[model samples]
Target chain A: MRSNSLTADLQPINKNIRKRFVLSRLHSLAGIVPLGIFMVEHLLTNSTALLGREKYNEQIHLIQSIPFLPLLEIFLVAIPLIFHAGYGIYLSMISKSNTQTYKYERNRLFFFQRVTGITTLVFIIYHVWSFRLAPVFYGTEINFDLVNSHLENVFVFSFYVIGVVGAVFHFSNGIRTGLITWGVTKGPASQRIAQRICLLFFAVFGVLGVTSLFAFI
Target chain B: MSAEKVIRLKVKRKDQMDSESYWEEFAIPYRPNMNVISALMEIQRNPVNAEGTKVRSVAWEYNCLEEVCGACSMRINGKVRQACSTLVEKLEQPIQLEPMETFPVEKDLVVDRQRMFDALQKIKGWIPIDGTYAMGSGPLISSREQQEAYKFSTCMTCGCCLDACPNVNSGSPFIGPQALAQTKYFNMHPTGKLTKNERLEVVIGDEGISNCGNSQNCVEVCPKDIPLTTALAELNHEANRYALWSWLKK
Candidate 1:
């Protein structure tokens, strides 16, 4: 039955469907690197808003005015977002029927990876809907000044606190898991590092969230 | 000789997947010879707790009632081990039984272990035959090879290796140590060699063997004491050879 053929069966599946799944994971990973880019860009944008709100508003217009920005976002950012999240969910489920994984590390990581994926998925959906899509659909302002001037009420600040905290968890976990996916870290160091990173992730994000929430409250 | 006294047990209980997890405590009449599983079985027969309440018996997994099946593995005194082998005499009073942390709690002790099974599937951890087409007993193996292969084949996928491994967790895609060892086991077979390259490729990939951190806990927790590190080390050699060979071919 080739029941012992752990190496045999993986060779011959049609590549197209397989490719899509692969592409999907690649997309999920793509979001991580760009997420870093987004964080930097966002911090820079928000710093100006905190300064006077006018500079932040001007900064947003100037950035959006760059050539083919929306086109780049649609292809590079948006498409990858949909594929990566969807594909990772699929891959995690797909491995279930194939192996009797008996190690601690695999099961633990796979479980949390799925959980964080789902969390990030839900959070991203909410963030995009509230900030990005809402501005277009509600025909309201999209500039940074509006968010700081009127929208910076306690409720909005609370959301930001929660939102940033969620983003931080997702980012750090995504980075750690991404390394595992790309095959970095080894042995006790890896384990120690993963633990450290998780604790670090939680602590940093928790502090940021609590501080931010308290500042507004 | 002084008689070994009773030890308390607060066992987490469940029946099947989708069942709720609960706890019950029992103070069994202790015998020096009593193992945790035997104690549990005794409790099962009695169905009475230390509080004198009639309750549903605790449910856990076991087979080979000898710790070979890895089914009886759970946290004993807050550490993971086989109940059949966990002697009551060695433990402190009030020993606790908790499910292994790495798997989804299917009921009380049984988890949906299909994840580990799927990893084995990913590596195909097998020797492909031409579909039982009247193939006779295929190849010869030396006693040394037989002995080594026998050791690895003893792996019952009990997940002790995974539980002890750091690379394995819910957040990463690493395939853990057992499957990587299985890859070498099959790769060692003369017939299995046909797929050695295939296994090597998988183990070398992202969720594959390259993710191993070599904490060596996998070896310590393995009831069979399979040399998982040795297997992984050998696989690493093979992976390098395969990569080099492919480069030469290019």
Candidate 2:
């Protein structure tokens, strides 16, 4: 059935193979997307704290109740990351072009984005281990309160502040780039729109994140 | 106000990728109608430095001296541009030549641009037309469409846009602006529309469009002035729509 549906996309012509070849780029790009989407969900869920910690906890618990939770995280989150981080590192090492040709303020942010994206990988594994897997392996109950408790530690909150801020910067830049890649913004007009969006997203993320860290510390 | 002023070419030189790089100044005999490439050719004819010392002729990359080839691109006065179109008279004294950092420097002003081409290959940056050699006229394209395609077609693949892009680097799989613009170009075609969803699928991926910081440097630096950021914005909406629609269909 799968083959039939795919074949219906086009005939067995060589063009079809070429189509698949082009489409296969998604495999590489997908490396960044699954995690990115989860982040959007994460932000929306966490933003509930604007109402109070109780609302945030209620949302978190509700999400945890989703069926097959463990498998979903393993496949959806872990698998995409394997590709995003692995190929990302491989590409960097063997890459011939380094895009740091310009040193504008925005360019500096881009440099930071690459550096942060790489480090974020390490932060993520530790995050997953400490948050998700540690409780399971040690047979301890973990929940939203535990996350809040982690924030109570100075080092832990510091780590969260850095990681989440870096991630927000990275993902907002993605939205800006997405506008360009998708043709939503173009010419000088799009440039203005992108600038506004970049600033807005970053500010929103920065405020929410900093506020959370402050509460924890 | 002086018309006969000479354009001093300060050429940055190296033997190979592994060789140490050094700067050599060559105040070549300048003329009224001269470009940076013409200035270099004058030095090529006589391999002598500004100090009148004999040295090995500088090595650089160029095919079609016309900007269409995109080979003779380099930094003139700290900006990425085609050496061919850069008028020497308007340039500041001591016109500098540096390789675009978008690729690995192979030597002097020559850098490895294989990755840009490879990205094109990875994105299958071409449309398939092999169905029937004797096939009739291809699909008709509107004038407006032709106007847009013409912008993408002007991409000399010079690596200039990549050079200007912040996300493009040895470390990031982010294919940079030129590739994403190319993806949009082909996808915009009538026949190319058949592969539209597939192209978007590639672009919306990790190393694809999302890595761009949207500084709009590519648009500013592009010699042909291709509307790059606009294409990227459109793709964002498409991807969002596609993901939602596909999930609904499922």
Candidate 3:
């Protein structure tokens, strides 16, 4: 009877054991590696706007002029992102939040991580469509003036602000949890230090990304 | 203080596994140095509701009145803990008691913790030694390793970690943190190291380490103060390395 109940309970999870482990690790790896690196590079590139229009445009042009830029974006940025976001959505769906009862800081953060992941995913989809895909299909040049015009609308500006902050929060918090997930920070003290470092990263990059948005305005 | 000082309790009760749950209040005369168990024993003795009528006695399981047995673990005042250790004086008025929702309640506060035991069986959470014949001394261990292992060794199979964990629930197949930490504990043994890969295989499986969301609540609610998250993080490293090595071998 015990075995029967146990098997019934575990039957849903028994299939593709090795595959799940590999995919889960790959999901974590993809987030921190390609997707995380892209966010950093993207933010730093945008922050070039603080150096003035020509510098920002020059950076964009330099990026655009790279040999096989589309391939690099597709393989490095797009695919990892698709997997991360897709798997992340599935993970979020499976996870049941108990923050109401547990009320621990990490438990609350765990709930927020899923929230920000979905938020960031939605924001990225729309942002990419507006700025990257639409520009390519419509033969519009992506320059300083283009971004400046887009941010001119208050609603668009607000959306960008929300999206940027959500994305930053997702990335920063992801690093903190990822450190634990990957076993880099073993103890609570080490985990706390990692959290502080990640928070510092969030504050610095959050200010930089938001300031860059203001730069375009 | 009045001699009539009473300790009020609001207990969430269920008659059976399928029965709907209801609240029953009890007012027992306050006693000095009374823990939740003694208060519960008082309730068992009286079996009367606050409305002053006789009722069936509340059913719960407990043994080794000390915290070590872990059978008396339940939600006391909204926190999952061993009822034996929680003092009445430290708690607020009309203390709330509920069975852990993570497990199926058998009746009242009695939950079927069979899943936790099943997980232990799945991970082979023990050192395999042939005891048929008297064997010589196994191996020597440095005190440093012993001290680290001793921390995890204190776990008493309490369900508090699972109750606290957001990722662990009836709907989820996650083996939860207790089994995961025990896997680490067993693997640390000299004899158990021989089967480390076998355990890692389970650890990397569907209901294994991958299911952990790293919320760190398991470590927070553990009665033994076991560094559960530390074990989890270490296991993650072990499982990852094992997965990578196997992948490379293929």
Pairs of residues at least 3 apart in sequence or in different chains that clash in candidate 3: none
- Stretches of candidate 2 exceeding 4 Å from the true structure: A1-34, A44-68, A91-99, A104-112, A139-149, A179-195, B1-8, B14-22, B27-38, B41-47, B56-71, B77-79, B87-94, B99-146, B149-218, B228-250
Writing each residue's lDDT as its tens digit, candidate 3 over B25-135 gives 999999899999999999999999899999888888899988999899999989999999999999997999999989999999999898899888787777877669877
Every candidate's lDDT? 0.68, 0.71, 0.89
Model 1 lDDT per residue over B42-131, tens place: 888988998999877777788888877878888776666788888888888788888876788777666667678887887777788866
Best by lDDT: 3
Best DockQ among the predictions, by candidate number: 3
Which ranges in model 1 have alpha carbons more than 4 Å from their true place?
A: A1-12, A16-24, A88-123, A137-141, A190-217, B1-27, B32-34, B37-80, B89-156, B161-177, B184-194, B200-250
- Every model's Cα RMSD, please? 8.5, 8.0, 2.8
RMSD value for candidate 3: 2.8
Rank candidates by DockQ, best first: 3, 2, 1
lDDT of 1 by residue, A16-90 (tens): 423432453455457676654565365445556444556767887888798998787787667777777776575
Residues A91-199, candidate 2: write the lDDT tens digits.
3454333345455655555456567777678778888888778988997665556777787888887888888887787677756554444445656665667768788
Task: Report the C-alpha lDDT of model 3 over A1-217, residue by residue, as the tens digit.
Answer: 5563322232333337777777888888999999888899999999999999999999999999999999998999999999999999888888889888788899988999999998899899989998999999999999999999999999999989989998999999999988977889988899999999999999999999999999999
Residue B87 in model 1: shift from native, Å?
A: 3.9
Runs in model 3 deviating more than 4 A are A1-15, B1-3, B131-135
Candidate 1 vs candidate 2: the TM-score winner is: 2
Q: Arrange candidates by lDDT, highest first: which order?
A: 3, 2, 1
